[model samples]
Target chain A: MTDATPSALSPLAIDVRGARYVYPTGNVTALGGVDLQVKPGEIIGIIGQNGSGKTTLTKLLNGLLKPTAGTVIVDGVDTAKKSVQEMAPHVGYVFQNPNHQLFARTVQMELEFGPRNIGLSEEEIAVRVAEAVEFFGLQDYIEEHPYRVSFPIRKLVGIASIVAMRPPILILDEPSTGQDHNTTHVINGLMRRLRDQGTTVVCVSHDMPLLADVVERVIVMKSTEIIADASPREVFADKTLMARTNLQAPQVTEIALQTVVPLGGPVALTPAELAADIAMRTGRPAAARTDAVG
Target chain B: MSMQAALPVAMIPGNSIIHRINPIAKLVWVVGYVVLAFSTQNIVVLYSMALFALLLAPIAGITKPLLKGALILVPVGSSLLALQIIAPAVERPWTPVGEIGPLTLYGDGIYYGFVLLGRIVASLLLALVMVMTTHPSDLFTSLSKLKVPYTLNFMLAMTLQLIPVFQREVGIIMSAQKSRGMKGKGFSAVLPSFVPVFVGAIERVQQLSISLESRGFGSNGIKTSYRQVRGRPSDWVIGIVGALALGGLSAYSIWRGTWNISSDIVFSPLFVVVTFVISATLFFGVVLFAVFLSLKK
Candidate 1:
């Protein structure tokens, strides 16, 4: 996947050709020449240590940031030639900090703000807001000020606001941040639903368990460059790369690598896969219940 | 440029004579500079005052950033010059010197414009030096030592520190709004951004208040600083001398009417030489910045 390049007419959701970004203030190089391509409806997880340019790369797709040196083609359009607002119809960005975006009088209004801003009809805005409310369990806080809600709920409002707009490419920056197990599951389910609906999902996260379950491909970055771009099983199987990048695979995958992989069993990305692999290696029947129950 | 860098006033860390000087001494110098700057319209003296601050930049190890920071003043200074050139504030008998697209240039207005620009440059550079060299905590401590209420001093210092933090926050908020399909232009679009900024600020202030209270910020106790700064004998000497010199110069300028430079003086060879020196210094500073950037790349 690291060497994979998109053909000019391949209908890519995102195409980056040698993108480089240097912060103007400190002249700090956040991204040192990156090239990437994402297909439509694919769920891509970007994993990296802090300051490794995962967020910077995603910002380029939505036109929030223009590459300092190379071209970024999103949905067959040059991002450099379009303003962020103009690109918003094609790409929806959920920021890391929810406080930066939540300012409406109510959560319902907050969810409707984006769709309305993009010129959706009032009826369509209400319908989208209702759908987001149900999807994210935001119905309870529909009439409350977004800031007046719990932090987790506020984060949901922030994400739902962007999701309401229903852009083709959705970028989530640390979606599971500050979320509990139940809310994390809700986000995981949402990503899967969006992917099934053919919305290209690009997620930047440190939540390995969620990524292992939700993402089809994981791109490992270190020091502003992609080190590995592969399937979740392939990426999690490499212990040396994970250690060098200061990252760890999902706990279940790690356990499988340590206990089952040496026994010639395949890598597991979830508790069920790990259990089945362990059962196969030991020639014992797997547990009847492996639903990852609390 | 990043929004924070666009704001020209900030602290730059360095170990130099200017950085080591007591904040009280530097504060006194600022006070004196402000008083002297406003007291005169003499372009030479004003430009010299600006030059003094620029000359100290290398010594302070802030030559690069300071020069880059001064780029903010170029547009302002040019606008002032252009505005005065087109609309002279001189009394009755206007001496029209040239024409700029049907706008008559008045000799008195041109001279006055330079004088005003000189004043602005001097004040701005001095403020930049004060900010770029002396850390906010040091200034807070100095104020505390001067019997200023500790609460007031703390607020002032915190305000200085938070300026950059809020600048970064505003940038993030603008980007977030833009990503949400908000119009990227017009004043109406900007007005919507303020709501989020204010809400974020309020939440931060709440957290800060809680953190402060947890650390006994409200207790009526004598606070001690971890970073001790004491006024040296040399500091007192420089402060006293600088203040007295500014006072003497202010009186001399007023009594001798030295600020009333006639048209003959503006055309003098020496005045041209002085103007050329000022322009050359600024030009070199900009050129040096460009070279430094290219070398860094």
Candidate 2:
């Protein structure tokens, strides 16, 4: 695959072309003939079964692994030409294991690691660190070692460290894994803020509902290739594609499909959306709708 | 960052003589090697000892670790040699070979430097051989069999396990830092990152202690192992032979006063030639294995 020249007027945030990856020792092909593209400021979710190349695809955007057969262009720069360090300012990756990434003595120092590494001025670093701490609600544990904190807080520290770098594109691998509903909601809120600030967010997760609530577009992968890419409504509405990928739509979406769809109501992603759709179908005011199914 | 290799001290699984040797026997062998290393300032003896350890590498299925060990030792041995060459021990009667700037090189200093390098390399390789061949569980069990305190054995086992885990954590942390734009490389760059690793390690230790207590660690009742390894006849033979050879060498070196700095090489010409031949063979064997591995990749 040839290198893509993203035009200045419509610059792509990420462009992957026929990327392939094979593990060094086992020679197992993690990704094969995969092509994907993300537009600027888009909230994208990548979903796939285990070994379906979701994490591998995300890693390619940040120069973590070079494509064996093709090219990955991030922010108009060829990822092959940049080291992970060089790619730091443009793309930030939060690994699944927070303990693996948190290395600073305190939460503040951990948050500052990225900004300091990128050579931000002391004042700018201080500002970003302060902002990250506040944004992540880390004020109480700012002075404490990240390891001494709870796992969920450590995960926040990991996210904040990357966020402090202020990369234009953020790739989170399994951000909602092992997280409770409240913590996932907090992460979803952060994702919304990042998107509102014009940062393109790419998340890979198995949490169907979180993806449904957060991402504008969902990309379904299978056998190392993207098989479906569409809006959440369109993607989740396709029962065959979801089944082939071993995925289920958000539970509320499923409930809406089962009860409301037969009754000529729209497919809803969230309970509120389902409620609104059901209210509209029943000729009732949306705010006065008591129960979605009723 | 490239995936870090497995821990250097972790045992490489195999069924060779070195691997089959009882861990207690290997520990005894390491002790004998250390004793012999310090008992002689003879360069020939030290090189032969190091060569023997290198020869054991292939048999133990740890050629990769041996190469890694050599890489680590080279810089350290060179620096020590350089320090000795520049500044000979002040108490020694020195014959000056040459002068570089304000530094004077002496024959005794140069010879002693080689002796020191050899001693360090030999002991290091011997220890590496033991560590690479024996599993931590087996080592702890052997220590138990030797009547070492259970608490001490447990500590040793935990230390061995934790070192690798911490190494992996350090790698992950470094990768995280690199992604954050850390430009500095090597130990100096990694020094600041150690704080988190230490903190993480402390937390892990606390959790581990709780888990251990719950699992009946330090219990008064008799404990049994899942895999029992009794000392075989070969273990006794190897241990006794190793002890006798090391003891004989130490006695001979003391009798000949070769433990101190000596002007003459002590080994016979034929013995020196054999040592050189064996060392060369082992070195080339390692090189060939590396070449094959690269080609396979």
Candidate 1, what DockQ? Answer: 0.45
Please state the CAPRI-style docking class of candidate 1: acceptable
Positional deviation of residue A278's Cα in model 1 after best superposition, in angstroms: 5.5
| Candidate number achieving the greatest DockQ relative to the actual structure | 1
DockQ list for all candidates: 0.45, 0.38
What TM-score does prediction 1 earn?
A: 0.84
Q: How large is the i-RMS for each model, in angstroms?
A: 4.6, 4.1
- Expressed as tens digits, the lDDT of each residue in B1-297 for candidate 2 is 234446766777778889899877788788998888888878888889999999999887789867886676655665555565556654667555655566565544556767888989999998988888887898888777777888898888888888778887786666666677776465546645666577678878899999999988888865556657779999988888888998788778878786664545443434333433443455566567667764541
Cα lDDT tens digits, model 1, B30-144, are 8888878888877778899999999989999888878878877865676666566557677868666655455565556667778788888898888788889998899888888
Native contacts kept, each candidate: 0.80, 0.60
TM-score of each: 0.84, 0.79
Q: Write the per-residue lDDT of candidate 1 for residues A199-294, one digit (tens) a residue.
A: 889999999999999999999999999989999999999989999999999999988888888888779898888887778767997877734622
User: Relative to the true interface, what fraction of contacts does candidate 2 keep?
Assistant: 0.60
Model 2, residue A266: C-alpha shift (Å): 6.1
Error of 2 at A222 (Å): 5.6
lDDT for model 1:
0.82
The 10-residue segment of model 1 chain B with minimum total lDDT is: B268-277
